[model samples]
Target: MLPGVVGTIQATEAVKLLLGIGEPLIGRLLTYDALGMRFREVRLRRDPKCPLCGTAPTITDLAVHRNGAGGACDVSPDGHPEGVAAAVAPKAGG
Candidate 1:
């Protein structure tokens, strides 16, 4: 998702949630265009086959989401951090 478009919608919804003045975009997705001045809403639905949110979820531990390599980071094709295992040995108990 393009962060510029999505981030604006999320920021707007967060303010609405704080003020309680209008319905927040809870359980729904919104797309917007500033130049065209258009807004579109798509209702979100729970996925039965999603590993993180499925009915019989397989991913139970938050540790699974953590980097097994600790602080090491790998750059994704899109330039985001993905975990990479530590290669150089460390002195024990340092």
Candidate 2:
């Protein structure tokens, strides 16, 4: 039953995103417990004073937070194409 409900909600959100309609669960955390058969939603809100996406954001450059440790993507230890699939894709697209 829990899986059924979760799948239904996931499908519903997918359709909503495709059509750009309905209020999606963007600002809420939904949880379900199978044994209890309970569903709960916790409202989420952004901090107004935070630098990122705030009224007066100061952090404009994202390079400061970029993880340059892995400067370049390379093949996995095993040298398998499928294993390095993630390394092939860029972190962020253009």
- Each model's TM-score? 0.48, 0.47
Q: Give the per-residue lDDT digits (tens) of candidate 2, residues 1-94.
A: 6568778988999999899999998877576667887887766566454455667765566643565735433323353223223433323411
Residue-wise lDDT of candidate 1 within 1-94, one digit each (tens)? 4467667777888899899979887776665656777876666666555555767665666655486855333323343222121322233421
Q: Which whole-number lDDT from 0 to 100 does residue 60 have in model 2?
A: 62
lDDT over C-alpha atoms for residue 50 of model 2: 45
Regions of model 1 farther than 4 Å from truth: 1-8, 19-21, 67-94
Candidate 2's error at 20, in angstroms?
Answer: 2.4
Candidate 2: give the clashing pairs: none
